[model samples]
Target: MASTASESKRVVIVTGAAEGIGRGIALRLANDGYNLGLFDLPKAEPNLTAVANEIRTTCGVRVSTVYGDVSQEEDVKRLVDIVVQELGSLYAMIANAGICINRPLHETTAEQSDKLLDINVKGTFYSFKHASIQLIKQGKGGRLVAASSIAGKRGFAEHAMYCASKFAVRGIVQCAALDYGEHGITVNAYAPGACETSLLTGVDEYFSERKGQPKGSYMEVFSAGSALKRIAQPRDVANLVSFFVSDDAAFVTGQTWLVDGGSVFD
Candidate 1:
């Protein structure tokens, strides 16, 4: 059993907490003294458990792990309920669970696009809705953060539907920010460029094959395109999320920040 929440420490829910950027954010927030409610799909049980245990032992912060698909409204609602029940109060929600598919627009099918939108767009919507409801009930100001890629800001080749879904996420964030501002809930998104994650690995593989280049050649090209002349690490993105959820950004909302090493200048 986990310890009860300390009033001094805030509690947050991070979806897709098993791996990649989600895992990075979880570890960073735990170290920052935030109790965590980590959510991910059932297939990610092993990685999720490991992250939970690591945080418990190292950060000594209370953590509650829940397995569910974010695309389901019931699952998201239950996730919020359980997290509050176990961790005490919900201070913020990080809707980082999303999927990507790399394929040309012409070759993309309805099924592929639907699945991508279901998880990336619909999943984000559900997370925002439930988290907002919980925060309003508590009558405490909170943060709502979601994953929006640089693709959400600009179109990329072979990322048709994926871009569409992320674009929708930005719209949702902006709208939610307006709707929830009066309730003291801030909404925003973090848009990462070519990050070193499994999602980028898939993008790397797709371009490598399409271009007939070596395995890592496309990744090198992606790295060079950024102003930093390198790719972003998971921790890099996590840092932005930390600031967004902190008191430092209480007045900042309805904006999608690009943490892409200056890849897409907005």
Candidate 2:
């Protein structure tokens, strides 16, 4: 069993907590009073230590950091073990570590496709696996939130591999929800569209190159395509995640909530 500073406090583990939507979710959960176990790649930028310190000081919650690639099985196990050993119990798991490779279906190599699937699909599965075991051992209800994408719901021209990986993640979330619900665990996913983050910067370049347009023009056109006529911020997606793991969302499970500002309504 993990050590616990306070047994009554809720504990959460967030993968990819170094930046973008993952970072936003971590901050929001900290503000909501959840003691955090943050996991990220070893050389992740944006300084996770700074974020952890901010949360600890501002939220007055215990914060732990684990450095590892979410796609690696050993790393995933280590992350969960650290959280369970240190926090004493695991209440929620957010599998938000993902990577994207933008290329036409024919242009994507087998290696590239496999890498995307490994990181986005298998990485998420490992997170769920370890977190579920820890939660069951703790003998308490738990929450599992995976990060799917709007691409998972609808395919884009150059996002074939990314879409496939996200679709698999959504499928996993649904299946896990059904299986774990019997154990009082709620599993769900969030699908965000065109979020304004560094991750989308590459997409802007890809579209600009394909269309022979300037980078700025490509993003403007893309934003206008959305019904909201704007790109989403990381915080917007984070807010939805915060709600899903909260007590208010206890009854919601096995669903994919879109945080796309009406980009894809089904």
Candidate 3:
């Protein structure tokens, strides 16, 4: 679809739109009548492109794809540049790309830690920076939403790096909110507990193996952590993001809202 074709609609960029939470958020925005710039890794292009097409067909919204890594500044810059140039104005950016590898603090390798931080922490920082720049340029209010985690609000054993990265996300959201509020920009984060996504498969397996239980037992362990006794769905996270980017949340900024079925008290 032509970028200008959707110019009349508010455009939002969703990184990691190929699957999981990113996909849910993208579709939700499209359903809400916003144009989209969907992005994911080059390896995920086929899936990302397919998702873009589906959103365009089902939601009847303009959808474009930007295949690149979020951890790199240059890639993020190019991604944002393409969004503004192609999709027109960028009113919101959802930095939802993330990965989690379950490893104990002592067993966590330097390489693994670096990779997680580069993608989870630096990638989020890049999204907030570039999105804020575009919003400031537009001279209109905008939303900067990110994915934090229960690990962000509180530390967990064997999740040092992940906790640290998510904590940084919350910190960035608060700082960016304060720094950009004068310009009518709001920054916030959605911190979900255990969600039903491929991202949690490794963690679930690790716990099950440790307990000598079957595959599904780990999911139960996570559910028990929540007061509601259930894991969150991707759509739950997407719904919280929808609120963050909506006009209803204009007064809300610099806050990290937890969507973990009462798992983490926030």
Each prediction's total of clashing residue pairs, residues at least 3 apart in sequence or on different chains, is 0, 2, 0
lDDT of 1 by residue, 113-210 (tens): 99999999999999999999999999988999999999999998999999999999999999999999999999999999988899889888889989
Our model 2 lands, by Cα RMSD against the true structure, at 3.3
Model 2 regions more than 4 Å off: 1-7
Best by TM-score: 1
Q: List the residue pairs that clash in candidate 3.
A: none
* Model 2: lowest-lDDT 10 consecutive positions: 1-10
lDDT of 3 at 135: 93
Which portions of model 1 show Cα errors greater than 4 Å? 1-7
Off by more than 4 A, model 3: 1-8
What lDDT score belongs to each candidate, Candidate 1 first?
0.93, 0.87, 0.89
TM-score of candidate 2 relative to the true fold = 0.94
Ranking under TM-score, best-scoring first? 1, 3, 2
TM-scores for all predictions: 0.97, 0.94, 0.95
lDDT by residue (tens digit), candidate 2, 54-81 = 8988888898899999889899999989
